[model samples]
Target: MANQSELDDHYTRMDKIFRLSLGEKGAYSCARFDGDFSMTTEAAQLKKYQFIEEGCKIKKGTKMLDIGCGWGHFVDYLTKKGVDAHGVVLAKGQADACIKNGLKVKHMDSKLITPETFGKFDAVTAMGSPEHLCSVEQYREGKQEMIYNTYFKQVADLLPIGGRYYCQSMVFGPKMVKFEDIKFGQTDLWKKEFTDEELMDIICEVFPGSWLPYGKEGLINPASKYFKVVSVDSGRLDYIETIHRWTAAFTAFNLQKYLLFASFVPDYLFDKTFRRWMRRFKIQANLHVFTREIFEHYRIVFEKVSD
Candidate 1:
């Protein structure tokens, strides 16, 4: 997958946009939304945190470790609820923000975590981290299962029996097109839609060294040896809604936000590659979901089991 530098550089370029679109908390993951579309992005994000709390059986005084805790929103939520919550992230911008807000967060890779590194925790939650745990290249090299198993074992070692691990991530959906068969700027996937090859390129730029799991089983099977899946839910539609709201947020930008956008004009006008990737990454994610069904989102809770 992506080395630490690649991951850091990728996030450095896009963190500002995420901060603008996701609001003060800087949440960057899918939000929960349904027929009742009245909830704001912040509210929906809190709902997601609530789901994690309930799923992991987190209560007051519970010691919880949040891996890849973007902007520390979940940690903030849990801490306010009287839970002893701590977070770790690889993004510099996110870690700085969380620290500035007086939250307990570390700027480091989650994969480096071990019982020796952080000691045993009562519970662990990886909101959007597992998707980055392995890359497509790693998977092609026959290392996906091994990587996942090792990751699960790390979490297992950090939790006592019956402790929980909550994970939410994007997984390959049904009818997915083969990787090699996917074309650039082609319309075969949809009646009148073109799959921009550049879109994939930009995605690579945006996420650098990350890849998604093939399906829920990709996670469940590997984790089965260490933890038992307690609950699983398809959050695909919720993600679709979350994306639309993000688009609207950027579109409804005000003067202050416009100033923020204007600051990037120099990069847009000069750094052609970065500009194109930045714009396309935002646009293509929504398009791919509707037209290609490239992936599905899932939220799962796994309880540690003694083996």
Candidate 2:
């Protein structure tokens, strides 16, 4: 899994850009669109949440936990509907914001979640979290499958028989470049001198210490041990639309975000690590990967059927 520091580097420090671009309580993950991209992103996000609510059979009194709950948007939404919604975020900024907004959230590691910690939840959702379950180093060490399997077991431990788990993640797609082709920590200017494969390497540069699963099966296979697959849907197009919307907002003038970015100018000029990190924004690498299907998004629901 991506360590706390790496996560903070990407999420905590850049929280403003995310919030500014998507608004205070916007959905940071891909919104759902059932072949109808015409709807506004907010509407699509509500649809996505509705799908989750129905899939989990959640009601006014249902207890739920949202893992990797960035900004606590879903948490706030559920709470408004009278559900007992709690969220856990690794990013300090997000947790603080949730608290400030009077949302139920804790700044803690998702892996530490257990019955002992917060007791059982009727349903658990891990939106955009599983992508960080395995780091590049862990993959290279051939521990990827074991890591995912263990994660499934941990999640199962937090649920009773028939409990539901909604998990959204980006998995390595067919077009993903070979592992060896990817490079890292090189201070080479963004897009200055890089081949197609090397350009793909910029993914790790932006989301340091994070690696994705191969395909939906990469998630279902391990999860089969403790849960039964309920539904699986390709969210590729929804993500494309979501990215396009976010790109527009990000490129739009935001004094605070720009000023925050400007402060990094000195680091970008002198620090190699910061320079590499900055490269992710120079060209918006996320859109490239999602557009090319180098990363495939999956929205899945799993039912805990066994211990």
Candidate 3:
């Protein structure tokens, strides 16, 4: 188990690596993660918005707060429907992009939020970002419980009695998947070029990420102490579809990069090989679809109880 300093260092390194791999523009483009650029046709985006609207019981002119609002997509969507929407994002690049796109967003961490700066929001939503909490070892050490409790307690404090908080997260799926088995292009090379163990080794070699499929039990159980669970939606199918789209878009982007910069043979070869590996990810995602019991994602809606 890593200490707090170690965990912080890991996150700092991860932030740098992610920013380098997914430039400002590319990351925003892939935020929807299903390759649908048009908002009208974006099933995933639309579903998320729909969930927010329904769960919050939002009305025209209702005030809303979005946590981890990537590129302010949900803010724009809500505002377009006549809801007064505000958002906070930790990524300066994403916030800048949103501003350039004429959307309003505050740059701040979720833990830093308060009713003073944000005012009271009628509803709050966080999508697929809470997993950024401390590492699994920290959770086992009991720090995770305190962290999550404080997070929800803050959200509850920011809302009126009966106000709502909606969240979508990658929860514990049916089975525990090793990080190595799911990484891009490592195992799927030329006819099982790498075994599952080899893939796991490669994952550990390249990254120190972890995956836990706890379903809604851990998050929902604690949150229910302070809020009532109104709805729980599963996203295993959607997640699989999302990954397939991401792999496809990434493949296209890398191919274009290779064609434009052929002088970089090593990079080109890596892209070519990586594309083949992405196909393996598609297979794994599909496997989850068939056995959702072993793998699942969740969208949970909760309403604060008045103190």
Most lDDT-accurate candidate: 2
Best by TM-score: 2
Worst lDDT run of 10 residues, candidate 1, spans 184-193
Model 3 TM: 0.69
Encode model 2's per-residue lDDT on 152-206: one tens digit a residue. 9999998989999999998988788888866665535544555546556677877
Q: Write the per-residue lDDT of candidate 1 for residues 196-231, one digit (tens) a residue.
A: 443453354557677677889988988999899999
Q: Note the clash tally of each candidate.
A: 1, 0, 8
The global Cα lDDT (0 to 1) of model 1 is 0.77
- Misplaced by over 4 Å in model 3 are 1-41, 177-213, 253-295
For all predicted structures, in order, the TM-scores are 0.90, 0.93, 0.69
* Residue 251 miss distance in model 2 (angstroms): 2.1
Q: Deviation in angstroms for 69 in model 3?
A: 0.8
TM-score ranking from best to worst? 2, 1, 3
Q: Over the stretch 107-140, how does candidate 3's per-residue lDDT look in tens digits? A: 6677778899868999988875565554545544
